[model samples]
Target: MERNAVEERVAQHYAGGIYAPDRAPEDMAIQSDTLFMFLMGEAGQREDMEAWMVRMAEAMDRIQELMDVLEARAEEKEESGAA
Candidate 1:
Protein backbone atom coordinates (compact mmCIF):
# COMPACT_ATOMS: atom_id res chain seq x y z
CA MET A 1 0.00 0.00 0.00
CA GLU A 2 1.09 3.55 -0.61
CA ARG A 3 2.03 5.69 2.34
CA ASN A 4 -0.33 8.42 3.43
CA ALA A 5 0.66 12.03 3.89
CA VAL A 6 0.94 11.71 7.66
CA GLU A 7 3.06 8.59 7.34
CA GLU A 8 5.32 10.28 4.83
CA ARG A 9 5.73 13.27 7.10
CA VAL A 10 6.55 11.08 10.08
CA ALA A 11 9.05 9.01 8.11
CA GLN A 12 10.78 12.16 6.93
CA HIS A 13 10.79 13.53 10.45
CA TYR A 14 12.45 10.44 11.93
CA ALA A 15 14.69 9.35 9.07
CA GLY A 16 17.67 11.16 10.60
CA GLY A 17 17.29 9.41 13.99
CA ILE A 18 15.15 9.29 17.13
CA TYR A 19 15.65 12.94 17.85
CA ALA A 20 12.81 15.07 19.15
CA PRO A 21 10.58 16.99 16.77
CA ASP A 22 10.73 20.77 16.32
CA ARG A 23 7.29 21.28 17.74
CA ALA A 24 6.44 23.60 20.58
CA PRO A 25 6.85 22.50 24.18
CA GLU A 26 3.10 22.60 24.70
CA ASP A 27 2.50 20.26 21.81
CA MET A 28 5.17 17.93 23.09
CA ALA A 29 3.68 17.90 26.54
CA ILE A 30 0.23 17.16 25.17
CA GLN A 31 1.53 14.25 23.15
CA SER A 32 3.31 12.86 26.21
CA ASP A 33 0.17 13.19 28.26
CA THR A 34 -1.93 11.37 25.68
CA LEU A 35 0.63 8.60 25.43
CA PHE A 36 0.71 8.26 29.20
CA MET A 37 -3.05 7.95 29.31
CA PHE A 38 -3.02 5.28 26.65
CA LEU A 39 -0.28 3.39 28.43
CA MET A 40 -2.11 3.47 31.70
CA GLY A 41 -5.37 1.74 30.80
CA GLU A 42 -7.01 3.51 27.88
CA ALA A 43 -5.29 1.63 25.08
CA GLY A 44 -7.53 -1.34 24.50
CA GLN A 45 -8.51 -4.78 25.63
CA ARG A 46 -6.57 -7.94 24.87
CA GLU A 47 -9.04 -8.86 22.15
CA ASP A 48 -8.20 -5.67 20.24
CA MET A 49 -4.63 -6.62 19.43
CA GLU A 50 -5.01 -7.62 15.79
CA ALA A 51 -4.09 -4.17 14.52
CA TRP A 52 -0.98 -3.97 16.61
CA MET A 53 -0.03 -7.49 15.59
CA VAL A 54 -0.41 -6.59 11.93
CA ARG A 55 1.74 -3.52 12.45
CA MET A 56 4.49 -5.68 13.91
CA ALA A 57 4.30 -8.05 10.96
CA GLU A 58 4.51 -5.14 8.56
CA ALA A 59 7.58 -3.80 10.37
CA MET A 60 9.27 -7.18 10.03
CA ASP A 61 8.48 -7.21 6.31
CA ARG A 62 10.07 -3.77 5.93
CA ILE A 63 13.19 -4.99 7.71
CA GLN A 64 13.36 -7.98 5.40
CA GLU A 65 13.07 -5.74 2.35
CA LEU A 66 15.92 -3.54 3.59
CA MET A 67 18.02 -6.63 4.23
CA ASP A 68 17.32 -7.89 0.73
CA VAL A 69 18.55 -4.61 -0.76
CA LEU A 70 21.71 -4.68 1.35
CA GLU A 71 22.38 -8.29 0.42
CA ALA A 72 22.04 -7.51 -3.28
CA ARG A 73 24.45 -4.61 -2.95
CA ALA A 74 26.93 -6.85 -1.17
CA GLU A 75 26.71 -9.44 -3.93
CA GLU A 76 27.26 -6.79 -6.57
CA LYS A 77 30.26 -5.39 -4.74
CA GLU A 78 31.75 -8.88 -4.36
CA GLU A 79 31.33 -9.57 -8.06
CA SER A 80 33.14 -6.33 -8.84
CA GLY A 81 36.02 -7.13 -6.41
CA ALA A 82 35.38 -3.93 -4.48
CA ALA A 83 36.91 -5.33 -1.27
Candidate 2:
Protein backbone atom coordinates (compact mmCIF):
# COMPACT_ATOMS: atom_id res chain seq x y z
CA MET A 1 0.00 0.00 0.00
CA GLU A 2 2.56 2.57 1.06
CA ARG A 3 5.12 3.39 -1.63
CA ASN A 4 8.28 2.78 0.37
CA ALA A 5 6.86 -0.38 1.88
CA VAL A 6 5.89 -1.65 -1.54
CA GLU A 7 9.29 -0.74 -2.93
CA GLU A 8 11.06 -2.62 -0.16
CA ARG A 9 8.89 -5.66 -0.75
CA VAL A 10 9.63 -5.55 -4.47
CA ALA A 11 13.35 -5.25 -3.77
CA GLN A 12 13.27 -8.28 -1.49
CA HIS A 13 11.37 -10.25 -4.11
CA TYR A 14 14.12 -9.45 -6.62
CA ALA A 15 16.76 -10.58 -4.19
CA GLY A 16 14.95 -13.83 -3.55
CA GLY A 17 14.32 -14.55 -7.25
CA ILE A 18 10.89 -15.94 -6.38
CA TYR A 19 8.77 -15.17 -9.41
CA ALA A 20 9.43 -14.96 -13.12
CA PRO A 21 9.55 -11.46 -14.59
CA ASP A 22 6.48 -11.68 -16.79
CA ARG A 23 4.24 -12.62 -13.87
CA ALA A 24 5.78 -10.73 -10.97
CA PRO A 25 3.68 -7.60 -10.93
CA GLU A 26 0.37 -9.37 -11.13
CA ASP A 27 1.38 -11.95 -8.60
CA MET A 28 2.66 -9.37 -6.18
CA ALA A 29 -0.52 -7.38 -6.51
CA ILE A 30 -2.61 -10.42 -5.83
CA GLN A 31 -0.55 -11.55 -2.86
CA SER A 32 -0.52 -8.13 -1.28
CA ASP A 33 -4.25 -7.68 -1.77
CA THR A 34 -4.98 -11.07 -0.32
CA LEU A 35 -2.85 -10.47 2.74
CA PHE A 36 -4.48 -7.14 3.40
CA MET A 37 -7.92 -8.67 3.33
CA PHE A 38 -6.83 -11.49 5.58
CA LEU A 39 -5.63 -9.07 8.17
CA MET A 40 -8.68 -6.86 7.93
CA GLY A 41 -11.11 -9.71 8.06
CA GLU A 42 -9.41 -11.17 11.08
CA ALA A 43 -9.50 -7.82 12.85
CA GLY A 44 -5.83 -8.12 13.49
CA GLN A 45 -4.26 -5.48 15.69
CA ARG A 46 -1.59 -3.09 14.61
CA GLU A 47 1.23 -5.47 15.37
CA ASP A 48 -0.38 -8.36 13.57
CA MET A 49 -1.20 -6.22 10.58
CA GLU A 50 2.30 -4.80 10.57
CA ALA A 51 3.87 -8.22 10.64
CA TRP A 52 1.77 -9.59 7.82
CA MET A 53 2.19 -6.31 6.04
CA VAL A 54 5.94 -6.70 6.08
CA ARG A 55 5.81 -10.20 4.66
CA MET A 56 3.25 -9.33 2.04
CA ALA A 57 5.13 -6.16 1.23
CA GLU A 58 8.24 -8.12 0.44
CA ALA A 59 6.26 -10.44 -1.82
CA MET A 60 4.74 -7.45 -3.55
CA ASP A 61 8.15 -6.03 -4.27
CA ARG A 62 9.35 -9.33 -5.67
CA ILE A 63 6.56 -9.40 -8.17
CA GLN A 64 7.34 -5.93 -9.47
CA GLU A 65 11.01 -6.77 -9.83
CA LEU A 66 10.13 -9.93 -11.69
CA MET A 67 7.96 -7.98 -14.09
CA ASP A 68 10.78 -5.54 -14.65
CA VAL A 69 13.12 -8.35 -15.50
CA LEU A 70 10.61 -9.85 -17.88
CA GLU A 71 10.13 -6.53 -19.60
CA ALA A 72 13.88 -6.02 -19.89
CA ARG A 73 14.32 -9.45 -21.41
CA ALA A 74 11.61 -8.76 -23.93
CA GLU A 75 13.19 -5.46 -24.86
CA GLU A 76 16.60 -7.00 -25.16
CA LYS A 77 15.31 -9.67 -27.47
CA GLU A 78 13.55 -7.12 -29.62
CA GLU A 79 16.67 -4.98 -29.86
CA SER A 80 18.77 -7.98 -30.88
CA GLY A 81 16.11 -8.79 -33.50
CA ALA A 82 15.60 -12.16 -31.95
CA ALA A 83 11.85 -11.70 -31.41
Candidate 3:
Protein backbone atom coordinates (compact mmCIF):
# COMPACT_ATOMS: atom_id res chain seq x y z
CA MET A 1 0.00 0.00 0.00
CA GLU A 2 1.21 3.50 -0.82
CA ARG A 3 1.78 6.10 1.91
CA ASN A 4 -0.94 8.34 0.51
CA ALA A 5 -3.44 5.44 0.52
CA VAL A 6 -2.64 4.60 4.16
CA GLU A 7 -3.03 8.22 5.16
CA GLU A 8 -6.34 8.47 3.33
CA ARG A 9 -7.71 5.35 4.99
CA VAL A 10 -6.64 6.52 8.46
CA ALA A 11 -8.21 9.91 7.90
CA GLN A 12 -11.43 8.30 6.74
CA HIS A 13 -11.68 5.89 9.70
CA TYR A 14 -10.33 7.97 12.55
CA ALA A 15 -12.86 8.91 15.22
CA GLY A 16 -11.17 11.02 17.86
CA GLY A 17 -9.20 10.95 21.08
CA ILE A 18 -10.84 10.78 24.51
CA TYR A 19 -10.11 13.68 26.79
CA ALA A 20 -10.77 14.30 30.48
CA PRO A 21 -13.51 16.62 31.67
CA ASP A 22 -12.83 20.32 30.92
CA ARG A 23 -9.69 19.31 29.06
CA ALA A 24 -9.01 19.74 25.37
CA PRO A 25 -8.04 16.87 23.09
CA GLU A 26 -4.46 18.15 23.03
CA ASP A 27 -4.27 17.73 26.83
CA MET A 28 -5.17 14.03 26.72
CA ALA A 29 -2.57 11.59 28.02
CA ILE A 30 -2.07 7.87 27.60
CA GLN A 31 0.08 5.26 29.31
CA SER A 32 1.10 2.80 26.63
CA ASP A 33 1.69 -0.06 29.08
CA THR A 34 -1.73 0.29 30.74
CA LEU A 35 -3.48 0.73 27.40
CA PHE A 36 -1.91 -2.47 26.03
CA MET A 37 -2.70 -4.33 29.25
CA PHE A 38 -6.37 -3.37 29.04
CA LEU A 39 -6.51 -4.27 25.36
CA MET A 40 -5.02 -7.70 26.04
CA GLY A 41 -7.45 -8.33 28.89
CA GLU A 42 -10.37 -7.28 26.70
CA ALA A 43 -9.21 -9.66 24.00
CA GLY A 44 -9.68 -12.57 26.40
CA GLN A 45 -13.18 -11.65 27.64
CA ARG A 46 -16.59 -11.53 25.97
CA GLU A 47 -17.54 -8.23 27.59
CA ASP A 48 -15.85 -4.91 27.12
CA MET A 49 -13.57 -3.34 29.78
CA GLU A 50 -15.55 -4.16 32.95
CA ALA A 51 -13.94 -7.52 33.70
CA TRP A 52 -10.46 -6.10 33.21
CA MET A 53 -11.37 -3.14 35.43
CA VAL A 54 -12.59 -5.45 38.24
CA ARG A 55 -9.29 -7.32 38.10
CA MET A 56 -7.46 -4.00 38.27
CA ALA A 57 -9.43 -3.03 41.39
CA GLU A 58 -8.69 -6.38 43.03
CA ALA A 59 -4.96 -5.95 42.37
CA MET A 60 -5.05 -2.45 43.84
CA ASP A 61 -6.82 -3.75 46.93
CA ARG A 62 -4.11 -6.37 47.42
CA ILE A 63 -1.45 -3.67 47.13
CA GLN A 64 -3.24 -1.48 49.69
CA GLU A 65 -3.40 -4.40 52.13
CA LEU A 66 0.38 -4.88 51.81
CA MET A 67 0.94 -1.16 52.37
CA ASP A 68 -1.20 -1.20 55.54
CA VAL A 69 0.78 -4.16 56.91
CA LEU A 70 4.03 -2.29 56.33
CA GLU A 71 2.72 0.85 58.01
CA ALA A 72 1.63 -1.14 61.08
CA ARG A 73 5.01 -2.85 61.35
CA ALA A 74 6.82 0.51 61.08
CA GLU A 75 4.73 1.95 63.90
CA GLU A 76 5.75 -0.93 66.18
CA LYS A 77 9.46 -0.11 65.64
CA GLU A 78 11.22 2.76 67.40
CA GLU A 79 12.26 5.65 65.14
CA SER A 80 15.80 6.99 65.67
CA GLY A 81 16.22 10.61 64.56
CA ALA A 82 20.01 10.39 64.29
CA ALA A 83 21.95 12.76 62.01
For model 1, residues 1-83, the per-residue Cα lDDT tens digits are 23334333333444352323334324565356543323212222223445544554776798899999999999999999997
Q: Model 3 over residues 45-74: C-alpha lDDT tens digits?
A: 424345555765777898899999988777
Steric clash count of candidate 3: 0
Candidate 2's C-alpha runs over 4 A off are 1-47
- Looking at model 2, the pairs that clash are 9-58, 9-61, 10-61, 10-62, 13-62, 21-66, 24-63
Taking all chains together, the TM-score of candidate 1 against the true structure is: 0.43
**C-alpha RMSD in Å of predicted model 1 compared with the true structure:** 12.1
Clashes of 1: 0
Ranking the candidates on TM-score from highest down gives: 1, 2, 3
Worst 10 residues of 3 by lDDT: 17-26
Clashing pairs in 1: none
Clashes (N, CA, C under 3 Å) per candidate = 0, 7, 0
User: Each candidate: what lDDT?
Assistant: 0.48, 0.53, 0.44
Residue-level lDDT tens digits of model 2 in 7-29:
44443454363432334334666
